[model samples]
Target: MGEVLSIKSILGQEEPEHMNDSMSEVDDDSRPPEKCPHCGKALKYKKFAIGHFTFGSHLEKCDCSGAEAEREREMREKERLQQEEEARKRMKRIEELFRQSRLGLRFREKTFENYKIMPHNKKAFQTTLEYARNFAKYKEKGEGIFITGDYGTGKTHLAAAITNYLLGKYTPVIMGNVTKLLGNIKRTYDDSQYTETEILKELYTVDLLVIDDLGKEKPTAWVEEKLYTVINERYENYRPIVVTSNLELEEIEQRLENCGGAIVSRIIEMCMGVKIKGPDFRKQKLEKGRDV
Candidate 1:
């Protein structure tokens, strides 16, 4: 009886071991298991498992929390690239427009980087820079600058520097020699390609007009009329004009004679005259050349 009881106990243990093996097989068959591609962790969930595809399903179907974060990161990168491309296109457009402007054509090299600022003219330089910094206010007020000084005192340099600075703000500047402007207008009578009206329109409409050697132009009835016309139009429109000259304010009046008062009046009304005093740099260069 003892031997039979021991045999029954051994059979009972073998049956339990067989049942445990069958349960393991059932669990494996219930779901296809695979490892996560990103983390290498075992995944029983079908959505998060590798080698599985779901049609028209959102990334949220994945069990890993990083799936949503990665999607967001990719979207942000795509947006950043798009914004960069837009900015590049905008900059190119701006360059093209500036290149076509009169200033870009006439004074291509008269930029701030090439301007020579002398120690004696520091205050004038600072004032010009400040004017550029506050250009919007000045433009709205129809205010401008009148640079009066001896020859070669860097008046042109400062004026060109202002234009160069203003270009960054997208303002168009036109610089012309007083004599040359009048000459071109006169030439228009014979030349069919350009008209006086068109030339004057550009002078009047530009954001900034810089007249170089203002008082040096030949004083005549025709020249005076044209000059006054240009100045008056700008005055009426409340546009800014920058003037560089070697004559004093009173001297300009004396030179203009009859139209002198009107022209000087407009100049004074529209601009603040800042006098620059310095040794003639040209004379200095000549003297140095002689010594050499």
Candidate 2:
């Protein structure tokens, strides 16, 4: 009878220990069984353990066409969001550049679509339109258009149109009357918000620079020096510039002969001349009004 009792006690202790081990295994199986919604397949679960201790279980990926497609969709969505963010940043930079460009409010409305196409100015119009459209190619080569024609012949209009078009494409461009631009720079000699070097640096480094009524500025020694500095620097750096002038190349050269003809030489080298000939639109309007 004592031997039987001893065997019973040993069996009882062994059974509880075995049951505890089984309970621990059950506790480690914490991950619920899941199915792939796309393929209706049972999702696998992986157990993570360190030595004798079990940490947890995690759902494993499903190997199916549906799962691959879902992953691709998610990846595409992520990529699209990243692209949108980049585009927003680009647009913001462009806006800041436009504000700094100093493009006048009067020229803001000038655009290729609103340009009137007349037989006399048709070629000039087409040439400028092509230049604006293929601006990237021209900019890469550091080539620009030199629009020379009579006063009020739409020269400045074409230059402004180019500025408006490029601005819309998020390109950094500066368009201003030559006299006004130079005057602004000169004002820096007195108390001003910007120094001469800072203003000149912006002019030199911009993507595109448009000088309206180029030869209309008073031909002074100081004026020629400033013009030469801007032109020579841009020429050296392979940056493009668009110029409009009421005077022809020869006249422009004579006007700035004090600069030793370097300005005209650089302009000729870097620009393709587009000559426009037509009755002055402003004059025509005034005459028509008088007749009416």
Candidate 3:
């Protein structure tokens, strides 16, 4: 019933046909029309077909010796336990990724129509998506999304959807809130045991980073330097950094008053900005008497 479990169920049902289907498929007359292999009762061909396909031809319902049945039962249980353990390990890894990271949100499915592009910057929004799709097609690479929108717009939702899709596809990704992220780095800097260099190494080296709520944190000299280092490092390394901000680019620059013009220029160069405009999405939903 949960989003992730639902997604897993959906994806499991769509598994690729990697098996040799022709070899696995039984011939019309391939079934042995004899007594059950264990107890020697009359055989059922339909049941035989299913049993052979799953448990192998040796697993005749009742015709096999009791010893054989017991052995098969043990093997099946062992296989089931092994599979469950593997699934548990994978879930643990995902949970750890979510825990140590600053941001995490994912949706199983998304589309432009589902997002409903905002009205204030409608033309630019449409064009930006088109460009993004085109870039994705040709380069087969993820692009940074520098989203500008008022609070309650669907900016974060849309970004989350993209990150979710990429993660499900097995691509490397990191998501976290902006303020928490800055606070983490700053605190780590203050702690002599946990060096900023060590932490920054992982943050800068990640494949994709979504810094949600970009301008929410109050900037300090250290925060500004670290931010600049990250942007510059990611840009040079060609790793994408997506930033969602309630404040516009101009306002962001104003806040970083002494950070120098070049750093701002570099941030702009690395990012592909798109401004979003409309009634606050939450307000609109409320006005419509709709549950968010």
Candidate 4:
């Protein structure tokens, strides 16, 4: 063999004539070493290999203050992506809940923001707003609200507002007119796609159940049985309910007499009573439209 040169000399200087054919070009030491863009420190060199063959050499990472900052930036970006993914999942879940809720288009616009506040509905409005605001605490305790008033007293509006508020917070809430809800369940008797038990289960397990126009539905034995079952199940499970009715507590008991007052009694125990008294908003609006 010719004079065997040290590895450092071969890399730092020029290669010998004998080794020029086998060895690739070494890094030029005359040129300045590549510096880290972030920290301006000279980058250390690292040789990459595969088995026994040395493939090449490249700059290794620098342990400068800027490196820590880059790591922190990457961590923050990861956290932001995680939060966005969680938000997307939550929105999808809320959409599914809305699909199952049976909330109609008529009530979709009935949010707290749009509810016309008047002297008659002011107390009920304030009460329902507070209930919705502290819904988390009340949900844990299974507390709810029972709203009673004459027709067009904003009873259903307030109920729908509560539904909207909770739904916006990603809480699973179901609200439907009492007549339509019972009608849907009754129709399930003929349709095998859904059973009465399945329908009632949704109502029982939802975070909050809003029953609108409660006394509007005709009281049959079947209706009373279903109503009692839903109420009793939710009551026993410590699930809250929001009821909007034109009847008072006593009237509701009388209206749903087939359940022997059990429905109204449980509702009384589960909810805080809010009675709204006012002129008919719908009638006033109609009159205004006619005048216009």
Candidate 5:
């Protein structure tokens, strides 16, 4: 019927008169100099307040104890970190459930399919293509390829093969150079559209993400963090990331310490470090009398 008050509050109010000395120092004109009613003194200058149900007062002057504030800050920070991480993971969850159609542009995007599926490599390549075609099948199964070799080799061919393969699985893959992706991510960082947290989420949140040629990007802090963030996050989450590199992991690590050790370590863990051993396919293809 009236403004209901809790019993603890009722008791605290009943006792504020005796317990809160600063309240007693109040009058119509000169109040207690913005000081704590519980303690007889004002806090330094800035006053922090929080709701304490057991305590009756809605607001009180707090001394802003460094230790207490730090503890409270740490607790709040922990909560903030947890919430951020959940939101990050939620981004991935949404991505996981997502079934994006391969657009005509993406679906029809030309690949090595233009090249005749030859015999010596045709069976192996076809098998690899089959694996890519079954994206949902193999991605969930974590079976993908490194798809590498020298320039003009079938690297792009197989990379594109897998990308197109996964396209129908409702989880389309994206293709780009190592350097440009790093640039775009760095731009996002500068533009603030994708916050660090968001970038971290998106890096690994997709169906399949590819970063071709690992060591080719320009060295920079933002690039390193973004590369590390995406790769490291994907590795940790066990997301499928297909990387084609002329340089191996040791070389990648040596060149891009900007990516950070933790991130590099995770990348190493997920990637089996496959080296496509052969002469440059371009050179092989070009030679006239090159015998088998």
Candidate 6:
């Protein structure tokens, strides 16, 4: 007959005859691993000793969506970093362009914001400002402007302001007194360092040009031809030219008589003449100095 099992033996207070077989079976290394409830994926399991085991679920392969969510989050972070890098590159490129341009070196101090606009020359001020603001349209239209007035009437100031505005926008601008320009050209003839063709090419190719003191130079035959060449090239290319002068239309026409109205016609055709009238700013400064 089978041995009767006591209460102590059943509760493990004493070992039974079949205890070795049961313990060996419980710690079998070939036992099946646990599986995830949601995805049926095999879970991690380990047997340390007889009847001793550990189990852990890999939630990445389960219905928790942990792995997918993490992947998406990483992708979004990568995109954000990429966008910031691109913005930094664009800003650097713009700064480099502005530095390379060196377009407004001379007129750095002249800008629309600091211009002194008065009631007497309000029309001229407004018109000039409008032209500068709408420079793109004027450039496309190949439009130009002629600013005429008495000496020290803020003609140079307005013209320089336009130059500064264009340069700030990265547009090419060249400005200088007509007499000085001629002088430079003449110097190039004496010194082989600079060439007339090179100088003229720069003046003609600029996006906008400001020719100040137009009638200040004596309009000789050679001078007229030089002026004609500069004006005619710009006119043919449909480039804009801004002129500031203390002379009236009639005076300019008479001064450049050697061109037989050719130069006058070209100036008139390309530019809209606007007369600026006001008390001379230089005189005002002088009077103020005297009072002081």
- Candidate whose TM-score is highest: 2
Global fold similarity of model 2 (TM-score): 0.70
lDDT tens readout by residue for model 5, 117-141 = 5544565466566666666665675
What's the lDDT for candidate 2? 0.79
CA RMSD, predictions in order:
19.7, 13.4, 15.4, 11.3, 17.2, 20.7
lDDT of 5 at 27: 23
Model 1 lowest lDDT segment of ten: 48-57
Candidates in order have lDDT scores of 0.72, 0.79, 0.61, 0.78, 0.56, 0.73
Q: Estimate each model's TM-score.
A: 0.62, 0.70, 0.56, 0.67, 0.52, 0.63
Model 3: how large is the Cα RMSD against the reference? 15.4
Best by lDDT: 2
Query: Which regions of candidate 6 are displaced past 4 Å?
Result: 1-107
Clashing pairs in 1: none
Give the per-residue lDDT digits (tens) of candidate 3, residues 71-173.
Answer: 7899999998886676566545544434555333343354444667545756655654564444444123434768888998767766665565555444455
Worst 10 residues of 3 by lDDT: 47-56
Candidate 4 residue spans exceeding 4 A from truth: 1-101
Which TM-score value belongs to model 6? Answer: 0.63
lDDT (Cα, 0-100) at 219 in candidate 2 = 89
Candidate 2 has its poorest 10 consecutive residues by lDDT at: 18-27
For model 4, name the residue pairs that clash: none
Model 5, which residues run further than 4 Å from truth?
1-112, 115-127, 141-143, 189-200, 258-264, 272-274, 278-292
Q: Provide the lDDT at 222 for model 1.
A: 89
Number of the candidate with higher TM-score, 3 or 5: 3
Residue 264, candidate 4: Cα error in Å is 1.1
